[model samples]
Target: MSTSPPAGPTPEEMRDMLRAMTLIRRFEERASEEYMAGRIGGFLHLAIGEEAAIVGTVSALRPDDPLTSTYREHGQALARGTDPRAIMAELLGRATGICGGRGGSMHLMDRERSFYGGYGIVGGSVPLALGLAWASHYRGDDRVSVTMFGEGAANQGVVSECFNMAGLWDLPIVFLILNNQYGMGTPVERAAAVEDFYPRATAYDIESWKVDGMDVLAVRAAISEAARLAREERRPACVELLAYRYKGHSMSDPDTVRDAAEKERWKARDPLVTFERVLLGEGIMDASAIAQMQAEVDQVVDDATEFAKGSPEVPVDQLADQVYAQPWNDDPRGSALVNP
Candidate 1:
């Protein structure tokens, strides 16, 4: 007995994508509430309206694929199938977190799931993704590496350099630019010389295309094509997902709120709503099924929140643990090794 998907995604696949996107939306909304209530610390970025791009892109990748991402990674984490409870606990800096609470929200590293670090620095993960792809190529593993960054990081010179190398070596890496219009406080139009980020890959002779990030199926199809070019053709490429962020760059940006008209314009194409309408219109799922899906997602998110709330915080004595390769023990040798 063999199991392989048909030519393209099926009805069930679309439904699954919808479920994942909805899950991320609910999780982020709850996370925002938790952040306001003082349950989470440090910088917090939400992908409230960019769920489709995240879920669709991740679903396009294979199980063995490795992914590196920017600080706006809560949605990516869920899309990659990281336990929502563990992710919440990590945000709370609990001892039982995915990275033992040291990584916090921005550094959700799950080795088992092959989701690498959620890099805090803009454009920092690009070269790392290239390296991962190169390593996989060297080992003949045939796995791809996907590096996702915001439009702000696209301007970094290091990203261009990485682009050159990825194309030159024909590494199997897909550079995904999540263009939410505004990069932090500055709009991308004012920041980058080239607004057509996808075609910019042509400068390095890499295949590229722009994707309507508001549509999950379109985004998934674009990424699936990119992955095919990498897997079968042994090439590298780029994709610019044109979506909008529903929240400020971070929770601390009080002045980052956008004008109501602009906000409503983007919200009009809300990925979650559009996907629901498509499914209902096609008769793939009835209204009751969609409602049931929403109810199930709410329960999952509620359970995750309750789990994180009751989880234990990292102990004071273990604060210095995992800072070095060796454990922080009372022994002099361990102390010297860590210090040295």
Candidate 2:
């Protein structure tokens, strides 16, 4: 007798995943619009096409697991259940932001969600993840730290150091390389002598794998296993997600370098569209149901935008409020400005 094909996610779970991806897509689109309109300041990096990789990896994780990511990480915060309004406020530099508007787009953190931050430096967050893992290992806690960085950052000396330390100490962590086929405008083939990222983990004696970043299920499966190996075995693991970004490196780039035909090929496999097809063809949801879901996601994004617009700007006087160390007020050299 043949066992029935392994059960898939429940209808509710499937819908949640699809809805999460939709929310990210719409949120990023609206963010781009707001940036262009000058409502959002500073560098803005959009992950419009990497929702599957973001949501899938986050979904596979435990709530208490600490996470770190590169500058392109609004999707990570969203997937970790940070309120969209707060995130939008952060981007808009309003006091209601998650970081009280101090961090802006490149530095978002929600301690409650265990999302440490989205570091501005290329591989800055990787070592932070390693530190968290080391803490967990030292404390005998079962938390597995996860870090997401670009393939460009994969070459960073700090990242290699973290890999070596993790392997040598058997730290519980997962290093997720979001290989979007480009390091900014430069293609992967041009950036590195050995382009395949997962294999490089072997140099540090860490187990590794690669997953289709466009396929949510595949990403979830791979990361779930990687997370398990890290947490249970108390060792390091790595995964390279093959994905593509539809936009330029940042809002400022004209995005002229990539070929139109290459973009079209990736768009044809758009994560949201492919997943929608799966939901429909598999009878998990009907067109009307999917339409309702889309409408809801749109409203969520719209509400977020309005909340951001209405929020108050961060006061300049409170600039030093979050700093942990206070300097002397009596110094003639203006240490008073920091102390005050």
Top-scoring candidate (lDDT): 2
What are the per-residue Cα lDDT tens digits for candidate 1 across 1-340?
0122225678998889999999999999999899999989998888889998998899899967899999999888898888999999899888877888888889998878888869899999999999999998999888989999988899889999988999899999999999998987788778988787877787898988887999998888888888888887889979899999988888888734577899999999999999999999988889999999999999999999999899999888887788655555666555645564
Residue 300 error, candidate 2, Å: 0.9
lDDT of each: 0.88, 0.90
Local distance difference test, candidate 1: 0.88
Candidate 1: stretches off by over 4 Å: 1-6, 255-257, 325-340
lDDT of 2 by residue, 102-191 (tens): 888999999999999998999999999999999999999999999999999999999999999999999999999999999889999999
| For model 2, the run of ten residues with the poorest summed lDDT | 1-10
Error at 184, model 1, angstroms: 0.9
Clashes of 2: 0
Residue 331 of model 1, lDDT score: 64
